[model samples]
Target: MAGSELPQEALWQRVAGRREGVLATLGPDGTPHLSNVYYLADPATRILRLSTTTGRAKGRNLLRDPRAALYVPGEDFFNYTVAEGRFEVAVASVTGEPAIDELHAVHAASGAAGDRPAFDRRMIRHRRMLVRAEITRLYGLVHPAA
Candidate 1:
């Protein structure tokens, strides 16, 4: 399969605009496990930041193994970006004001939440941990018309 190289700027824009992405990790049984996540991408550093509750399976898996894969498919389904990445997991116990502020701003802009209270509750209940993924390998796939 032929693929195109997506520039850094393009990759950031695409990931930032997307609503959800699938995170792939290895299960306890050695099977590939997938979960949907809301992420923030810093194209400048080529790092993808994912926030989740600290005690989840994904979080636990990262604690055991740092290797992971992130896939953000295009809205059109025919075009998508796949990134095989790796990160060093850090347990972020306390959520900083700056991070929450940025999350609020991005959430508002994306229209991800229907209301502020609901969003705030969701963020609060979940123990926030940051998964900083460095893009080790990236490729863009465009499915041609049949």
Candidate 2:
């Protein structure tokens, strides 16, 4: 992981373009909780947004432990980036408050489309939440594992 390192800008750029990654949160027992998640990156703020259900392990883990990391793969097995960050969870709103709005933003960022009201209802029904990870550091290999 310590050879030719990618500049911070390059890391952020890859994050913004990568569609998905493996998010690792800490379980109650301090073990690693991993989940394959779709994400949207804000390179300007260094934040990554993702939507999930409260019932999911990742959601619960983030609520308990804000520390998290996202493993973003590159075009091939040789390349990858690991983004370390802290989480900020926003619960799903039942009455379409700012929480729902933020969730919608995340949905939109993912290029998903649907009826607004219906989406809000589903978000509430599923106890959906937005998990924003403010990335603190980026590291990984950008070359072949060999």
Candidate 3:
């Protein structure tokens, strides 16, 4: 779809519905590191939000390198919405205070009530950090076989 006509709501729906996406970051060895993560995407702002443990491969990788990519598969392996973006990492100095409350509110306003129990638990357990990524490029790919 053309950039102007790229229905942000539809894109966000696809993202929120997916369970896993490949989060690629630069490893310490200067190679790509990929991991699966559960994430929240805000269509209006075009920001994808995710949370990680205080210290993990992905987190460490982000610290070393802020550039990252996220890939959400379509119906099949051949079809997918891939986003190449860079994150401005904001580590939470305080713990347990609803990291993405604004985003969550947006979701709610859009009639997209997420997994409440899971969200509550996350709000309670992990320190909230925000990764604001500006989607530099996004495209949908479909292989011939699919």
Candidate 4:
């Protein structure tokens, strides 16, 4: 990684460790639609994944435009990281059983532990889609020591 980019360890410790992030997607008018999203990260591939349904605003925005940014705050104040990348959308039907597991991970990462059966049903009923972001650039002042 370049000096301007976040180190591998910092990426894992801060971005991947966080349960939630603010996702900014482009609206049709080219404005940003920001929303809180529970996400899972793969430090190995530098990809961030989140769950959303096509009926939702963010999902609709992403379908129209794939450009996005994810901002994750550190455990402490005054520190955060931003990952800018293209957001890819995949519906459960295309992804199969793994989509369910991936959506569950989003809920689990968000600290939701109750009513697993109901949650599963709702996810399927809503036609849950997974959003994958491959980090093309990294920003913010989150240090590993922070």
Q: Which candidate is the best by lDDT?
A: 2
Off by over 4 Å in 4: 1-9, 75-77, 94-97, 110-121, 142-146
Question: Residue 44 of candidate 3: its Cα lDDT?
Answer: 65
lDDT, candidate 4, 13-70, per-residue tens:
6787776889999898998899998888987888888988999989999888898899
Error of 1 at 76 (Å): 2.8
Q: List the residue pairs that clash in candidate 4.
A: none
Predicted candidate 2 versus true structure: per-residue lDDT over 33-144, tens digit per residue: 8999988887689988889999999999988888889999998877888998778998886756887887788888767736788989889888998898888898876763
| Model 1 alpha-carbon drift over 4 Å, by segment | 1-13, 94-126, 144-146
RMSD of each: 4.2, 2.4, 6.0, 4.2
Candidate No. with top TM-score: 2
Error of 4 at 41 (Å): 1.3
The lDDT of each candidate is: 0.68, 0.85, 0.66, 0.77
Q: What is the TM-score of each candidate against the true structure?
A: 0.68, 0.88, 0.67, 0.76
Candidate 4: deviation at residue 9, Å?
A: 4.2
The runs of at least 3 residues in candidate 3 whose Cα sits more than 4 Å from the true structure, single-residue gaps closed, are 1-13, 16-19, 95-128, 143-146
Ranking by lDDT: 2, 4, 1, 3
Write down the lDDT that model 2 would get.
0.85
Ranking by TM-score: 2, 4, 1, 3
CA lDDT for candidate 4: 0.77
